[model samples]
Target: MKQKRRVRVMVAKPGLDGHDRGARIIARAYRDAGFEVVYTGLHQTPEEIVEAAIQEDVDMIGLSSLAGAHKYLFLAVVELLREKAADDIVVCGGGIIPDDDIKRLKESGVKEVFTPGTPLDDIVKWVKHNITPRQD
Candidate 1:
Protein backbone atom coordinates (compact mmCIF):
# COMPACT_ATOMS: atom_id res chain seq x y z
CA MET A 1 0.00 0.00 0.00
CA LYS A 2 1.92 2.99 -1.28
CA GLN A 3 -0.98 5.33 -0.65
CA LYS A 4 -2.13 5.31 -4.23
CA ARG A 5 -4.21 8.06 -5.73
CA ARG A 6 -7.40 7.56 -7.67
CA VAL A 7 -6.10 5.94 -10.87
CA ARG A 8 -8.61 6.05 -13.67
CA VAL A 9 -7.92 3.81 -16.68
CA MET A 10 -9.51 3.29 -20.09
CA VAL A 11 -8.90 -0.06 -21.75
CA ALA A 12 -9.68 -0.02 -25.46
CA LYS A 13 -9.52 -2.34 -28.44
CA PRO A 14 -8.75 -0.52 -31.65
CA GLY A 15 -8.81 -1.44 -35.32
CA LEU A 16 -10.39 -4.74 -36.38
CA ASP A 17 -8.93 -6.54 -33.43
CA GLY A 18 -11.60 -9.02 -32.56
CA HIS A 19 -9.52 -10.69 -29.85
CA ASP A 20 -10.41 -9.15 -26.50
CA ARG A 21 -10.05 -11.97 -24.03
CA GLY A 22 -6.83 -10.37 -22.86
CA ALA A 23 -8.29 -6.89 -22.70
CA ARG A 24 -11.19 -8.03 -20.61
CA ILE A 25 -8.83 -9.77 -18.22
CA ILE A 26 -6.68 -6.69 -17.92
CA ALA A 27 -9.66 -4.48 -17.23
CA ARG A 28 -10.73 -6.82 -14.48
CA ALA A 29 -7.23 -6.77 -13.02
CA TYR A 30 -7.24 -2.99 -12.94
CA ARG A 31 -10.61 -2.91 -11.30
CA ASP A 32 -9.46 -5.44 -8.73
CA ALA A 33 -6.45 -3.25 -8.09
CA GLY A 34 -8.90 -0.49 -7.11
CA PHE A 35 -8.65 1.59 -10.26
CA GLU A 36 -11.56 3.26 -11.98
CA VAL A 37 -11.51 1.58 -15.38
CA VAL A 38 -13.61 2.70 -18.35
CA TYR A 39 -13.60 -0.13 -20.86
CA THR A 40 -14.11 0.95 -24.47
CA GLY A 41 -15.55 -1.91 -26.42
CA LEU A 42 -14.20 -3.34 -29.68
CA HIS A 43 -13.20 -1.48 -32.83
CA GLN A 44 -12.62 1.99 -31.38
CA THR A 45 -10.82 4.66 -33.36
CA PRO A 46 -8.14 7.02 -32.17
CA GLU A 47 -10.53 9.92 -31.88
CA GLU A 48 -12.91 7.90 -29.74
CA ILE A 49 -10.12 6.79 -27.45
CA VAL A 50 -8.84 10.30 -26.98
CA GLU A 51 -12.29 11.67 -26.45
CA ALA A 52 -13.05 9.16 -23.76
CA ALA A 53 -9.75 9.76 -22.03
CA ILE A 54 -10.27 13.52 -21.94
CA GLN A 55 -13.92 13.32 -20.96
CA GLU A 56 -13.12 10.87 -18.18
CA ASP A 57 -9.80 12.49 -17.25
CA VAL A 58 -8.21 9.10 -16.86
CA ASP A 59 -4.69 8.58 -15.65
CA MET A 60 -3.83 5.94 -18.23
CA ILE A 61 -4.87 4.64 -21.68
CA GLY A 62 -4.52 0.96 -22.45
CA LEU A 63 -4.89 -0.33 -25.98
CA SER A 64 -5.32 -3.96 -26.94
CA SER A 65 -4.84 -4.51 -30.65
CA LEU A 66 -4.30 -7.89 -32.26
CA ALA A 67 -5.42 -7.16 -35.82
CA GLY A 68 -1.90 -6.35 -37.08
CA ALA A 69 -2.97 -2.72 -37.52
CA HIS A 70 -1.27 -1.63 -34.34
CA LYS A 71 1.30 0.46 -36.15
CA TYR A 72 -1.20 2.66 -37.90
CA LEU A 73 -3.72 2.68 -35.09
CA PHE A 74 -1.12 3.51 -32.46
CA LEU A 75 0.32 6.36 -34.45
CA ALA A 76 -3.12 7.81 -34.96
CA VAL A 77 -3.84 7.59 -31.26
CA VAL A 78 -0.58 9.31 -30.31
CA GLU A 79 -1.13 12.04 -32.87
CA LEU A 80 -4.65 12.56 -31.57
CA LEU A 81 -3.38 12.87 -28.03
CA ARG A 82 -0.99 15.54 -29.19
CA GLU A 83 -3.64 17.28 -31.24
CA LYS A 84 -5.98 17.42 -28.25
CA ALA A 85 -3.17 18.44 -25.92
CA ALA A 86 -3.68 15.32 -23.88
CA ASP A 87 -0.08 14.21 -24.12
CA ASP A 88 0.22 14.24 -20.37
CA ILE A 89 -1.79 11.06 -20.12
CA VAL A 90 0.28 7.89 -19.87
CA VAL A 91 -0.20 5.43 -22.77
CA CYS A 92 0.56 1.72 -23.07
CA GLY A 93 -0.65 -1.20 -25.15
CA GLY A 94 -0.78 -5.00 -25.22
CA GLY A 95 -1.48 -7.51 -27.99
CA ILE A 96 0.20 -9.58 -30.65
CA ILE A 97 2.63 -6.86 -31.68
CA PRO A 98 6.05 -7.77 -32.96
CA ASP A 99 9.33 -7.02 -31.26
CA ASP A 100 10.32 -4.39 -33.79
CA ASP A 101 6.99 -2.61 -33.48
CA ILE A 102 7.43 -2.27 -29.76
CA LYS A 103 10.50 -0.07 -30.23
CA ARG A 104 8.75 1.99 -32.84
CA LEU A 105 5.67 2.40 -30.67
CA LYS A 106 7.83 3.69 -27.85
CA GLU A 107 9.52 6.08 -30.23
CA SER A 108 6.13 7.34 -31.35
CA GLY A 109 5.29 8.48 -27.81
CA VAL A 110 3.76 5.40 -26.28
CA LYS A 111 5.46 5.24 -22.92
CA GLU A 112 5.28 1.46 -22.81
CA VAL A 113 3.93 -1.60 -24.61
CA PHE A 114 3.17 -5.04 -23.28
CA THR A 115 2.86 -8.05 -25.48
CA PRO A 116 1.15 -11.37 -24.83
CA GLY A 117 2.17 -13.13 -21.62
CA THR A 118 2.84 -9.93 -19.73
CA PRO A 119 1.73 -10.24 -16.17
CA LEU A 120 -1.05 -8.08 -14.83
CA ASP A 121 1.20 -7.13 -11.96
CA ASP A 122 3.63 -5.63 -14.43
CA ILE A 123 0.91 -3.50 -15.95
CA VAL A 124 -0.27 -2.35 -12.56
CA LYS A 125 3.31 -1.58 -11.59
CA TRP A 126 3.82 0.52 -14.68
CA VAL A 127 0.71 2.57 -13.94
CA LYS A 128 1.63 3.04 -10.33
CA HIS A 129 5.09 4.18 -11.25
CA ASN A 130 4.00 6.51 -14.02
CA ILE A 131 0.89 8.20 -12.65
CA THR A 132 1.15 10.76 -9.89
CA PRO A 133 -0.89 13.33 -8.06
CA ARG A 134 -1.46 16.57 -9.96
CA GLN A 135 0.89 19.13 -8.50
CA ASP A 136 -0.58 21.81 -10.66
Candidate 2:
Protein backbone atom coordinates (compact mmCIF):
# COMPACT_ATOMS: atom_id res chain seq x y z
CA MET A 1 0.00 0.00 0.00
CA LYS A 2 1.10 3.56 -0.69
CA GLN A 3 1.91 5.74 2.27
CA LYS A 4 -0.09 8.96 2.52
CA ARG A 5 1.58 12.17 3.46
CA ARG A 6 1.04 13.44 6.96
CA VAL A 7 -1.90 15.82 6.90
CA ARG A 8 -1.57 19.27 8.38
CA VAL A 9 -4.82 20.58 9.86
CA MET A 10 -5.79 23.92 11.36
CA VAL A 11 -8.34 24.03 14.13
CA ALA A 12 -9.96 27.44 14.33
CA LYS A 13 -12.72 29.19 16.21
CA PRO A 14 -14.33 31.80 14.02
CA GLY A 15 -16.49 34.77 15.00
CA LEU A 16 -17.08 36.00 18.54
CA ASP A 17 -17.25 32.59 20.12
CA GLY A 18 -14.93 32.32 23.08
CA HIS A 19 -15.58 28.68 23.92
CA ASP A 20 -12.71 26.47 22.81
CA ARG A 21 -12.87 23.15 24.64
CA GLY A 22 -13.97 21.28 21.57
CA ALA A 23 -11.46 22.88 19.27
CA ARG A 24 -8.67 22.10 21.70
CA ILE A 25 -9.79 18.53 21.98
CA ILE A 26 -9.84 18.10 18.23
CA ALA A 27 -6.44 19.68 17.86
CA ARG A 28 -4.93 17.34 20.41
CA ALA A 29 -6.58 14.36 18.80
CA TYR A 30 -5.18 15.32 15.43
CA ARG A 31 -1.74 15.60 16.96
CA ASP A 32 -2.02 12.22 18.63
CA ALA A 33 -3.20 10.69 15.38
CA GLY A 34 0.09 11.72 13.75
CA PHE A 35 -1.20 14.70 11.83
CA GLU A 36 0.37 18.12 12.12
CA VAL A 37 -2.09 20.51 13.80
CA VAL A 38 -2.41 24.23 14.28
CA TYR A 39 -4.86 25.85 16.65
CA THR A 40 -5.85 29.45 16.14
CA GLY A 41 -6.84 31.08 19.38
CA LEU A 42 -10.46 32.07 20.00
CA HIS A 43 -12.42 34.97 18.43
CA GLN A 44 -10.67 34.86 15.09
CA THR A 45 -12.29 36.43 12.07
CA PRO A 46 -12.69 34.53 8.85
CA GLU A 47 -9.91 36.48 7.18
CA GLU A 48 -7.58 35.83 10.08
CA ILE A 49 -8.29 32.15 10.05
CA VAL A 50 -7.70 31.87 6.32
CA GLU A 51 -4.52 33.87 6.58
CA ALA A 52 -3.23 31.56 9.26
CA ALA A 53 -4.05 28.52 7.19
CA ILE A 54 -2.22 29.93 4.19
CA GLN A 55 0.73 30.97 6.28
CA GLU A 56 0.92 27.56 7.88
CA ASP A 57 0.20 25.84 4.58
CA VAL A 58 -2.31 23.52 6.13
CA ASP A 59 -3.94 20.67 4.22
CA MET A 60 -7.33 21.20 5.83
CA ILE A 61 -9.25 23.59 8.08
CA GLY A 62 -11.60 22.60 10.89
CA LEU A 63 -13.87 25.27 12.31
CA SER A 64 -15.73 25.14 15.60
CA SER A 65 -18.44 27.67 16.34
CA LEU A 66 -21.26 28.00 18.84
CA ALA A 67 -22.15 31.64 18.47
CA GLY A 68 -25.16 30.89 16.25
CA ALA A 69 -23.18 32.40 13.38
CA HIS A 70 -21.67 29.26 11.92
CA LYS A 71 -23.45 29.79 8.62
CA TYR A 72 -21.97 33.21 7.98
CA LEU A 73 -18.59 32.68 9.59
CA PHE A 74 -17.96 29.24 8.14
CA LEU A 75 -19.03 30.26 4.66
CA ALA A 76 -16.94 33.40 4.87
CA VAL A 77 -13.79 31.37 5.53
CA VAL A 78 -14.59 29.04 2.64
CA GLU A 79 -15.22 31.99 0.34
CA LEU A 80 -12.00 33.66 1.35
CA LEU A 81 -10.07 30.49 0.68
CA ARG A 82 -11.71 30.20 -2.72
CA GLU A 83 -10.89 33.80 -3.51
CA LYS A 84 -7.27 33.22 -2.56
CA ALA A 85 -7.11 30.23 -4.88
CA ALA A 86 -6.64 28.03 -1.87
CA ASP A 87 -9.82 26.01 -2.24
CA ASP A 88 -7.71 22.88 -2.26
CA ILE A 89 -7.67 23.14 1.48
CA VAL A 90 -10.43 20.87 2.76
CA VAL A 91 -12.83 22.68 5.08
CA CYS A 92 -14.95 21.11 7.82
CA GLY A 93 -17.02 22.41 10.70
CA GLY A 94 -18.23 21.22 14.08
CA GLY A 95 -20.61 22.63 16.66
CA ILE A 96 -24.28 22.88 17.44
CA ILE A 97 -25.48 23.42 13.91
CA PRO A 98 -28.83 22.00 12.87
CA ASP A 99 -29.28 19.31 10.23
CA ASP A 100 -30.87 21.87 7.90
CA ASP A 101 -27.87 24.14 8.22
CA ILE A 102 -25.40 21.30 7.65
CA LYS A 103 -26.65 20.78 4.09
CA ARG A 104 -26.27 24.44 3.27
CA LEU A 105 -22.88 24.55 4.91
CA LYS A 106 -21.68 21.70 2.73
CA GLU A 107 -23.08 23.43 -0.33
CA SER A 108 -21.22 26.59 0.66
CA GLY A 109 -17.92 24.61 0.45
CA VAL A 110 -17.60 22.86 3.77
CA LYS A 111 -16.54 19.29 3.03
CA GLU A 112 -18.25 17.97 6.16
CA VAL A 113 -19.87 18.95 9.43
CA PHE A 114 -19.52 17.25 12.82
CA THR A 115 -22.11 17.71 15.48
CA PRO A 116 -21.39 18.05 19.20
CA GLY A 117 -21.24 14.35 19.97
CA THR A 118 -19.14 13.10 17.06
CA PRO A 119 -16.25 10.88 18.01
CA LEU A 120 -12.75 12.23 17.61
CA ASP A 121 -11.65 8.97 16.02
CA ASP A 122 -14.29 9.33 13.34
CA ILE A 123 -13.18 12.86 12.59
CA VAL A 124 -9.53 11.88 12.45
CA LYS A 125 -10.23 8.93 10.22
CA TRP A 126 -12.43 10.94 7.89
CA VAL A 127 -9.82 13.65 7.49
CA LYS A 128 -7.03 11.19 6.87
CA HIS A 129 -9.06 9.44 4.21
CA ASN A 130 -10.54 12.49 2.54
CA ILE A 131 -7.81 15.15 2.47
CA THR A 132 -6.15 15.70 -0.87
CA PRO A 133 -2.40 15.93 -0.48
CA ARG A 134 -1.05 19.36 -1.21
CA GLN A 135 1.24 19.28 -4.19
CA ASP A 136 3.14 22.46 -3.65
Candidate 3:
Protein backbone atom coordinates (compact mmCIF):
# COMPACT_ATOMS: atom_id res chain seq x y z
CA MET A 1 0.00 0.00 0.00
CA LYS A 2 1.25 3.44 -0.81
CA GLN A 3 1.78 5.68 2.19
CA LYS A 4 -0.33 8.82 2.21
CA ARG A 5 1.60 12.07 2.13
CA ARG A 6 0.65 14.22 5.07
CA VAL A 7 -0.16 17.89 4.49
CA ARG A 8 -1.77 19.52 7.49
CA VAL A 9 -3.48 22.88 6.98
CA MET A 10 -5.33 25.32 9.20
CA VAL A 11 -8.36 27.08 7.68
CA ALA A 12 -9.13 30.04 9.88
CA LYS A 13 -11.72 32.84 9.97
CA PRO A 14 -9.93 35.73 11.53
CA GLY A 15 -11.08 39.00 13.14
CA LEU A 16 -14.70 40.19 13.39
CA ASP A 17 -15.73 38.24 10.32
CA GLY A 18 -18.79 36.14 11.00
CA HIS A 19 -19.58 34.65 7.62
CA ASP A 20 -18.10 31.17 7.29
CA ARG A 21 -19.66 29.37 4.34
CA GLY A 22 -16.61 30.03 2.17
CA ALA A 23 -14.20 28.92 4.81
CA ARG A 24 -16.11 25.67 5.21
CA ILE A 25 -16.06 25.10 1.46
CA ILE A 26 -12.32 25.52 1.28
CA ALA A 27 -11.82 23.22 4.26
CA ARG A 28 -13.83 20.47 2.59
CA ALA A 29 -11.94 20.93 -0.65
CA TYR A 30 -8.58 20.60 1.06
CA ARG A 31 -9.75 17.51 2.91
CA ASP A 32 -11.00 15.98 -0.31
CA ALA A 33 -7.60 16.69 -1.80
CA GLY A 34 -6.14 14.45 0.93
CA PHE A 35 -4.84 17.11 3.26
CA GLU A 36 -5.45 17.02 7.01
CA VAL A 37 -7.09 20.36 7.71
CA VAL A 38 -7.78 22.16 10.98
CA TYR A 39 -10.64 24.63 10.83
CA THR A 40 -10.54 27.54 13.26
CA GLY A 41 -14.06 28.85 13.32
CA LEU A 42 -15.12 32.49 12.99
CA HIS A 43 -13.78 35.28 15.23
CA GLN A 44 -10.25 33.94 15.46
CA THR A 45 -7.55 36.33 16.47
CA PRO A 46 -4.14 36.41 14.77
CA GLU A 47 -2.64 34.87 17.87
CA GLU A 48 -5.19 32.06 17.87
CA ILE A 49 -4.54 31.31 14.23
CA VAL A 50 -0.78 31.14 14.64
CA GLU A 51 -0.96 29.21 17.89
CA ALA A 52 -3.27 26.69 16.29
CA ALA A 53 -0.92 26.37 13.35
CA ILE A 54 2.05 25.73 15.59
CA GLN A 55 0.22 23.33 17.86
CA GLU A 56 -1.46 21.49 15.02
CA ASP A 57 1.80 21.66 13.09
CA VAL A 58 -0.01 22.61 9.91
CA ASP A 59 1.91 22.99 6.65
CA MET A 60 -0.27 25.90 5.58
CA ILE A 61 -2.58 28.55 7.03
CA GLY A 62 -5.64 29.30 4.90
CA LEU A 63 -7.67 32.30 6.00
CA SER A 64 -11.11 33.48 4.79
CA SER A 65 -11.52 37.07 5.76
CA LEU A 66 -14.18 39.10 3.95
CA ALA A 67 -14.81 41.58 6.73
CA GLY A 68 -12.42 44.05 5.07
CA ALA A 69 -10.05 43.67 7.99
CA HIS A 70 -7.49 41.62 6.13
CA LYS A 71 -4.91 44.37 6.47
CA TYR A 72 -4.83 44.36 10.24
CA LEU A 73 -5.43 40.63 10.61
CA PHE A 74 -2.92 39.60 7.98
CA LEU A 75 -0.23 41.94 9.27
CA ALA A 76 -0.65 40.76 12.84
CA VAL A 77 -0.58 37.15 11.78
CA VAL A 78 2.57 37.73 9.75
CA GLU A 79 4.30 39.45 12.60
CA LEU A 80 3.39 36.71 15.05
CA LEU A 81 4.49 34.05 12.62
CA ARG A 82 7.84 35.77 12.42
CA GLU A 83 8.02 36.05 16.19
CA LYS A 84 7.31 32.36 16.59
CA ALA A 85 9.79 31.58 13.81
CA ALA A 86 7.20 29.62 11.84
CA ASP A 87 7.19 31.84 8.78
CA ASP A 88 7.66 28.84 6.53
CA ILE A 89 4.01 27.91 6.59
CA VAL A 90 2.38 28.87 3.30
CA VAL A 91 -0.47 31.37 3.86
CA CYS A 92 -3.09 31.72 1.15
CA GLY A 93 -6.80 32.28 0.55
CA GLY A 94 -9.48 34.22 -1.33
CA GLY A 95 -12.05 36.90 -0.53
CA ILE A 96 -13.35 40.33 -1.53
CA ILE A 97 -9.83 41.72 -1.58
CA PRO A 98 -8.88 44.60 -3.85
CA ASP A 99 -6.17 44.09 -6.50
CA ASP A 100 -3.68 46.56 -5.04
CA ASP A 101 -4.25 45.24 -1.51
CA ILE A 102 -3.37 41.79 -2.77
CA LYS A 103 0.14 42.93 -3.71
CA ARG A 104 0.58 44.64 -0.36
CA LEU A 105 -0.49 41.57 1.57
CA LYS A 106 1.97 39.40 -0.35
CA GLU A 107 4.81 41.63 0.75
CA SER A 108 3.80 41.08 4.37
CA GLY A 109 4.46 37.32 4.26
CA VAL A 110 1.37 35.97 2.56
CA LYS A 111 2.56 33.38 0.06
CA GLU A 112 -0.53 33.62 -2.10
CA VAL A 113 -3.87 35.45 -2.09
CA PHE A 114 -6.67 34.20 -4.23
CA THR A 115 -9.29 36.52 -5.58
CA PRO A 116 -12.96 35.54 -5.70
CA GLY A 117 -14.00 32.90 -8.25
CA THR A 118 -10.70 31.04 -8.10
CA PRO A 119 -11.19 27.37 -8.90
CA LEU A 120 -10.88 24.91 -6.05
CA ASP A 121 -8.38 22.92 -8.05
CA ASP A 122 -6.23 26.01 -8.30
CA ILE A 123 -6.12 26.35 -4.53
CA VAL A 124 -5.20 22.71 -4.06
CA LYS A 125 -2.59 23.04 -6.77
CA TRP A 126 -1.16 26.14 -5.19
CA VAL A 127 -0.70 24.42 -1.86
CA LYS A 128 0.79 21.31 -3.43
CA HIS A 129 2.99 23.35 -5.69
CA ASN A 130 4.33 25.83 -3.17
CA ILE A 131 4.21 24.26 0.30
CA THR A 132 7.73 23.38 1.46
CA PRO A 133 9.48 22.33 4.61
CA ARG A 134 10.63 24.98 7.01
CA GLN A 135 14.25 26.04 6.61
CA ASP A 136 14.77 25.93 10.32
Candidate 4:
Protein backbone atom coordinates (compact mmCIF):
# COMPACT_ATOMS: atom_id res chain seq x y z
CA MET A 1 0.00 0.00 0.00
CA LYS A 2 1.18 3.51 -0.80
CA GLN A 3 1.54 5.84 2.13
CA LYS A 4 -0.03 9.29 2.01
CA ARG A 5 2.24 12.32 1.71
CA ARG A 6 2.36 14.53 4.75
CA VAL A 7 0.90 18.00 4.41
CA ARG A 8 3.67 20.60 4.29
CA VAL A 9 2.88 24.08 5.62
CA MET A 10 4.78 27.31 5.99
CA VAL A 11 4.10 29.53 8.97
CA ALA A 12 5.09 33.10 8.17
CA LYS A 13 5.25 36.41 9.96
CA PRO A 14 4.47 38.93 7.32
CA GLY A 15 5.19 42.67 7.42
CA LEU A 16 6.93 44.52 10.26
CA ASP A 17 5.16 42.53 12.97
CA GLY A 18 7.76 41.93 15.62
CA HIS A 19 5.47 39.70 17.69
CA ASP A 20 6.04 36.05 16.90
CA ARG A 21 5.05 34.08 19.97
CA GLY A 22 1.80 32.97 18.40
CA ALA A 23 3.46 32.05 15.14
CA ARG A 24 5.99 29.95 16.98
CA ILE A 25 3.29 28.18 18.94
CA ILE A 26 1.33 27.35 15.82
CA ALA A 27 4.43 26.03 14.09
CA ARG A 28 5.12 23.72 16.98
CA ALA A 29 1.49 22.61 17.05
CA TYR A 30 1.61 21.82 13.36
CA ARG A 31 4.86 19.92 13.74
CA ASP A 32 3.46 17.95 16.62
CA ALA A 33 0.35 17.17 14.62
CA GLY A 34 2.44 15.37 11.97
CA PHE A 35 2.58 18.12 9.36
CA GLU A 36 5.91 19.28 7.96
CA VAL A 37 6.29 22.92 8.91
CA VAL A 38 8.63 25.65 7.71
CA TYR A 39 8.70 28.81 9.76
CA THR A 40 9.80 32.12 8.31
CA GLY A 41 11.01 34.43 11.03
CA LEU A 42 9.66 37.88 11.85
CA HIS A 43 9.58 40.94 9.55
CA GLN A 44 9.08 39.06 6.31
CA THR A 45 7.66 40.73 3.24
CA PRO A 46 4.77 39.21 1.30
CA GLU A 47 7.08 38.54 -1.62
CA GLU A 48 9.55 36.77 0.61
CA ILE A 49 6.82 34.63 2.18
CA VAL A 50 5.43 33.57 -1.17
CA GLU A 51 8.90 32.85 -2.52
CA ALA A 52 9.80 30.67 0.40
CA ALA A 53 6.43 28.90 0.29
CA ILE A 54 6.90 28.02 -3.35
CA GLN A 55 10.51 27.03 -2.91
CA GLU A 56 9.66 24.81 0.04
CA ASP A 57 6.71 23.37 -1.89
CA VAL A 58 4.28 23.94 0.94
CA ASP A 59 0.64 22.95 0.58
CA MET A 60 -0.52 25.78 2.82
CA ILE A 61 0.64 29.07 4.31
CA GLY A 62 -0.33 30.30 7.77
CA LEU A 63 0.40 34.01 8.11
CA SER A 64 0.49 35.81 11.43
CA SER A 65 0.38 39.58 11.78
CA LEU A 66 -0.11 41.73 14.86
CA ALA A 67 0.99 44.93 13.14
CA GLY A 68 -2.38 45.89 11.61
CA ALA A 69 -1.10 45.52 8.07
CA HIS A 70 -3.11 42.39 7.39
CA LYS A 71 -5.24 44.07 4.78
CA TYR A 72 -2.33 44.94 2.56
CA LEU A 73 0.16 42.24 3.43
CA PHE A 74 -2.17 39.26 3.39
CA LEU A 75 -3.81 40.22 0.15
CA ALA A 76 -0.45 40.82 -1.45
CA VAL A 77 0.62 37.27 -0.76
CA VAL A 78 -2.59 35.91 -2.27
CA GLU A 79 -2.17 38.09 -5.33
CA LEU A 80 1.45 37.11 -5.76
CA LEU A 81 0.51 33.45 -5.60
CA ARG A 82 -2.05 33.96 -8.35
CA GLU A 83 0.41 35.96 -10.43
CA LYS A 84 2.92 33.16 -10.07
CA ALA A 85 0.27 30.53 -10.78
CA ALA A 86 0.70 29.06 -7.34
CA ASP A 87 -2.78 29.80 -5.98
CA ASP A 88 -3.33 26.13 -5.38
CA ILE A 89 -1.44 26.65 -2.15
CA VAL A 90 -3.96 27.46 0.57
CA VAL A 91 -3.51 30.74 2.46
CA CYS A 92 -4.74 31.56 5.94
CA GLY A 93 -3.93 34.16 8.57
CA GLY A 94 -4.13 34.91 12.28
CA GLY A 95 -3.37 37.91 14.48
CA ILE A 96 -4.95 40.91 16.15
CA ILE A 97 -7.17 41.35 13.13
CA PRO A 98 -10.60 42.86 13.45
CA ASP A 99 -13.72 40.86 12.62
CA ASP A 100 -14.51 43.24 9.80
CA ASP A 101 -11.15 42.61 8.27
CA ILE A 102 -11.63 38.88 8.61
CA LYS A 103 -14.63 39.03 6.31
CA ARG A 104 -12.61 40.99 3.79
CA LEU A 105 -9.69 38.61 4.01
CA LYS A 106 -11.92 35.63 3.36
CA GLU A 107 -13.62 37.28 0.42
CA SER A 108 -10.24 38.14 -1.00
CA GLY A 109 -9.16 34.49 -1.17
CA VAL A 110 -7.76 33.65 2.24
CA LYS A 111 -9.19 30.23 3.10
CA GLU A 112 -9.44 30.87 6.84
CA VAL A 113 -8.37 33.15 9.68
CA PHE A 114 -7.71 32.34 13.30
CA THR A 115 -7.91 34.96 15.98
CA PRO A 116 -6.28 35.08 19.40
CA GLY A 117 -7.36 32.53 22.01
CA THR A 118 -8.32 30.05 19.31
CA PRO A 119 -7.61 26.50 20.36
CA LEU A 120 -4.53 24.91 18.86
CA ASP A 121 -6.34 21.65 18.41
CA ASP A 122 -9.03 23.38 16.43
CA ILE A 123 -6.40 24.82 14.15
CA VAL A 124 -4.83 21.42 13.70
CA LYS A 125 -8.17 19.84 12.96
CA TRP A 126 -8.98 22.52 10.45
CA VAL A 127 -5.79 21.81 8.55
CA LYS A 128 -6.39 18.09 8.59
CA HIS A 129 -9.92 18.52 7.26
CA ASN A 130 -9.18 21.21 4.72
CA ILE A 131 -5.74 20.58 3.30
CA THR A 132 -4.24 17.57 1.65
CA PRO A 133 -0.62 17.14 0.64
CA ARG A 134 0.11 18.26 -2.84
CA GLN A 135 0.42 15.30 -5.16
CA ASP A 136 3.37 16.69 -7.06
Best by lDDT: 4
Model 2 per-residue lDDT tens digits across residues 1-136: 7976678899999989999999999999999989899998999999999999999999999999987999999999999999999999989999999999999999888999999889989998998789866866
Model 1 per-residue lDDT tens digits across residues 80-112: 999988888878888899999999999999889
The CA lDDT at 112 in model 4 is 99
- Model 3: residues with Cα > 4 Å off, grouped in runs: 1-4, 133-136
Off by over 4 Å in 4: none
**Ranking of all predicted structures according to lDDT, beginning with the best and ending with the worst:** 4, 2, 1, 3
Candidate achieving the largest TM-score: 4
The true-versus-predicted C-alpha distance at residue 30 of model 1, in Å, is 0.6
TM-score of 1: 0.92
Deviation in Å, model 1, residue 13 alpha carbon: 0.6
Among all windows of ten consecutive residues in candidate 1, which has the lowest summed lDDT? 127-136
Candidate 1, RMSD to the unseen true structure: 2.6
Candidate-wise lDDT, in order: 0.87, 0.92, 0.86, 0.96
Better of 1 and 2 by TM-score: 2
Instruction: State the displacement of the C-alpha of residue 24, model 2, in Å, after optimal TM-score superposition.
Output: 0.3
Candidate 3, residues 46-129, lDDT tens digits: the string is 999999999998888998889899988987888899899988777775788998889999987887898789999998898888
Off by over 4 Å in 2: 1-4
Error of 4 at 53 (Å): 0.6
